[model samples]
Target: MNEHITEIVIFTALFLLVSGMGFVAARWRRADNLASLNEWGLGGRNFGSWITWFLVGGDLYTAYTFVAVPALLFGAGATGFFAVPYTVITYPLVMLVLIRLWSVSHVHGLVTPADFVRVRFGSPTLALLVAITGIVATMPYIALQLIGIEAVLKTMGVTGDLPLIIAFAILAAYTYQSGLRAPALIAFVKDILIYIVILVAVIYIPARLGGFGSIFDAADAKFAKTPAPGDGTLLNANNQLQYITLALGSAMALFLYPHSVTGVLASRSRDVIKRNMSALPAYSLLLGLIALLGYMAIAAGITPIGTDVNTVVPQLFDQMFPDWFTGVAFAAIGIGALVPAAIMSIAAANLFTRNIYKEYLRRDATDAQEARVSKLTSLVVKVGAVLCILLIDPQFSIDLQLIGGVIILQTLPSVALGLFTRWFHRVGLIAGWTAGMTAGMVLLYNIANPANNHAHFGGSAFPLSKLGFDTPMTVYAGFLALIVNLAVAALATVLARRLGSSEGVDGTSPRDYTADAGDPEVKDDLEVAGST
Candidate 1:
């Protein structure tokens, strides 16, 4: 092993500390028995504002934001910076929708968004679609986290897949033991490390490389030498559509991920959700700062160690910082992967247990049985994610996740908008989801990245002319697919209503959407429903 001893030692020490905390997290907010889905999957639905802030922030920001965003910026220029505005606008969008979701979920004892769909539309079929989409959408995402870990491991001079296997094994063990609580506790350490590392890097790197002006100038000069259209410091007219649509589509998709909603539902109350949404934008500011590392990498004249641009940040730190500090940053990135990976696996497992296993396989499953199944399923999900990275190209996995955004965005019509108005017929929502998902996948498949040998599933950018727009404009496949989805859903709803199709019973009331914690109705309803 050609590992840098100092960096590896520090990284290992910090990682061990977090692993210890992960195991102990099972007892952090001790419950009588974590046999209940509420206790294991949702952290007993009692997280306060501070814990909720870190948990949700840690869950959403992710290793992708840390590694992939900078990597994109390094490789593709301003287009990668789309993450900044997406994250900026995400808070307001979430604040508008998530408070209501929390209220409704709390009142109904809903553990997954699929459960809410099952209750709202009273259609198990529609709920099953939502559940399956979440699991499929989340799998690539979990794989992306492993990519994050792999990047750090590679930067530390650790080769082979053994280290990756060991790290994920530790992550799986803790998540299996503590479920959401493990990530909720580890999120604190992860965020703190990230903040310190990012703050120092932002301040120190720019100063070391002359200034931000030098960094931009270096990036501009580099991109100007390249023939790629959008690979520059500023956006051109042709690429502006892509930037806008990507940012908008991403904002729409952000909260739809099962893990994002899992964080919201785990909050103690609706007020906690509101407070966290407002405060979460601080991380967006951090994200914008982090994206600049791409420019900084260019300024530092750091060549990526391999074809994987995702390693830009790690390689940059390896070159720029002291050995000990590099270790700290690597730990931040590695632990960063763990937090979201744990949450995502737990979230996906919860969906399977509630929506698939219990709803279909065993309707009479007890709370303990549900928890048991969720824990094991979480292990399976993580294993699948690891295999995704081992078997597929890392860049392909990143591209898959970008398309995964499009996949999850299909849920917005059913889940997000469904939170406000039941105007969308359940049948219509199901049709819309199907249309959007299919169109998005087809479009993604047709866009080829020949240079990377990715003939199908190459990238998320599809040309507008393909849709008969008579323009050479390229737009995000997800946004266009969403348009098709909405249009189809509206037309389908009209037809369904005219044909006298049943609109199933609404199990949720308007009051349910505004209920808060400590409300007698909310508490009593959950108590009567038992653990779900």
Candidate 2:
């Protein structure tokens, strides 16, 4: 085979192997019934610490992580390193949020956050809004994974989106058949291959480019000569606060994501969630190594050959390693995209079937029907994601995901706060969601960069200049939107309580928050009720 053909052959073989593992996953769990939503969607909720660790890690640290993080460092310099602290902080933040979510979900057997939001706040309308918001935010994200595979394809000189379409179709099929277990099983292999690829790239690429010092020095010298000042290896006073706030803000929003919550909620126990968070920080170490690939690209004089930052890692692999080894790295990223993409589709589909379809459209739907609808919906979700990759600009796909972060953040007050107390009226939560969402959209649409004449776009810091600021201060949209959300929630909460509105009974007891896996009360389903 020609070199390009050889790369394609190797990638295809590796992907097929992963898909085969996916088909075997349902059998791996020896699921009691494949036709049940619980068995299919959540893997019977029996994932222990080790399996849950890999599943959650794989679900959270995606193809986007492998490609985008390094690409950020490569393209923007120090600002790209924001991913470092964001990932470092994500575990502890999730540790706090997930323990409560696990307890409540396990207690009520709730499958999606929308399910929790609906029951906890006593509002079907709000739950539907949350469900729709989640699906919208997650769709672009699922497509972004295709960008990762497309990156590998482009590096190998493989052209056309047709191949990516075929690959994703295969992914959707197995995921539909095997459900969460499919992705969870394949995650084991994806993580292993990615770890190997990152380890080798970190060690060998630096040596080839002289060393880490040489790489950084070269990057610094290059940027110094170029007109892109302060665009090198360090964050400066101008952007330091923005970086810190964006990093922490993203960490807070990370687990609040519907798919992320779905991933954590599938675990068997509270301790399982905690242990995974503790051990999951090691992914940050891998991420640190991965981020340096950007510096290596700069040292190797690599600039993005395309607009997609997702291609940087693959291009770096093509330049730094042999053809066969490059194929391996390509496979890692391609399969990496597959694992999370599958899980995201499944999560989004579950939200639709449980929170939307069953709640509003078909209250009498059977377990078998729920399973069928979820499978069909999973297929549709993957199809829409592919259309996004085909019809929209890849750069816009990334921006849309950031907007998803903004949208998902709006639910934090309703979902996260509701887990603590129902003192906040449902009406107040809805009002807060509306206010925060409107403010976020307006601010996001108004954000612009002088570098590009594009309107209503750009992922950089939003200047507060129009709001009367001259100090070069900028803030992330997601963080700013969250502040508005909390403020509206607090204000509306006071008014609702003052007006003597009933907050409704929370079926969840105080003891539910600390219940363990084996606790009989955990599965008793004290308040198994929802929208008609």
Candidate 3:
């Protein structure tokens, strides 16, 4: 501890400084009243393009990008590049739909995706399922953020749960005080540190190790000796399908996560979201550069702490950089976890407060009541995330995120598609959600990992031979589960129509999906004009 005191001092100082910024963020925009969900949970819904860019980028490209993605590459080789296509495809796909979501949300005063479902199909039951799904999916995601911070701490020789608990307490306190603004304000610092750390790592590290050529050669040589078919510097026949499907499924499920929606909905207008999505893909290039760190780790002979490859990037920095700069890189990762964890907890809390508490516990809950419940629920959500880290430590941090993807994808028919088409009957959506979640669970349960001897819930890649296929190919379980979800929903819709079941009320008009900022029809109760 004495030997590494400089790094610890720097890291702790930066972390505490950011926590201070989080507390000050409550006054950053100084909303007239901090009692409304619209003000507290969505940052007054008025952040401009630049702010939204930093907030959303900081949220999406999280510790998963900083710690897990490189760790994945360090462990599995090219298969980790799945994140590249996931980010690339995510923006264009969501650009076409998120604006519609933003428009409808603004027009109707919706706070969560489930709130939209409640209005669209006029089915509280379906909306409840969407809410539950979002909350359940986000928990492990929050846990992943914690795991990222833990990775950095472990590298710094900080062991046990005390430091983690302290980090969690600080995150919860500031997040409770500042709400969405905490993350939004702190995001500016998080992104700047990440850019510097990544940019320097990409340029300086490769040069120190000879070049990118040596990095690839080192990675190739390492993976070639591995027994796994999918472990290589390049894709092989068996895992190609897994690579493509994981990328595609991850892309589809990303924006559907409540935190991602929270980031987008906080924007001042559809135009801001449009600009952010168009430009957010630039981070994908950074992601690719970050992924290469795994190979660089291989070239530098950096090994993960114990079996957790999640520590590889942090380990690489400690091994390759000076003690002072290593602290900066580590802080980028620790704070990186903080920004997304705050947003995710808040997102899950909003889902519970608006869709569950307000809808069932108290029909007459005012904006203040909802905001109060959301803040409390956010604290509960953080506790749940902490429990997850203490108990169900997955083989890879990314698996926790992939598990979330599989569950959240079940809501596509009810949330993303329902933004445009309500062809899916409310009952059919419930049925599909049930079937999809069950199938996803069973598939995830059956996926065994020979690496760590994990017999179940090992990972998301499902081998095809289990289905009697003669080939050695495997595919992403989430993508396959989504297929089952869509199929079941379609069939259930046909069955409901033939049975003459009640067609639920549609609470929204066509204009709601296309209305822009300052449109007379769109509600002006939410102040979004000047904050830009």
Q: Give per-model TM-scores.
A: 0.97, 0.96, 0.97
Give the alpha carbon lDDT tens digit for every residue of 444-480 in model 3.
9899998878798788899989989998899999888
**What would the TM-score be for candidate 2 when compared with the true structure?**
0.96
**Candidate-wise lDDT, in order:** 0.89, 0.83, 0.89
> What local lDDT does model 3 show for residue 281?
85
- lDDT (tens digit, per residue) of candidate 1 on 111-140: 898999999999999999999999989999
lDDT of 2: 0.83
lDDT of 2 by residue, 1-532 (tens): 4567767778889999998898888798676577766778888777888888888889888998888888878876888899889999888878777788888777777889888887787788888988988898899889889988888888888889889999998899899889999988999999999899999999999999999999999878876776754367898777787798889877877887777887887787788888888898888899889999988988988767656566777888888888788888899999999989998998899999999999999999987888899999999999999999899877788779878888888888888777787777887888888988888887788887544456776664777776788877778877788788888888998998999987866667778777777788666221222211
Query: Who is ahead in lDDT, 2 or 3?
Result: 3
Which pairs clash inside model 3? Answer: none
Q: Which scores better on TM-score, 1 or 2?
A: 1
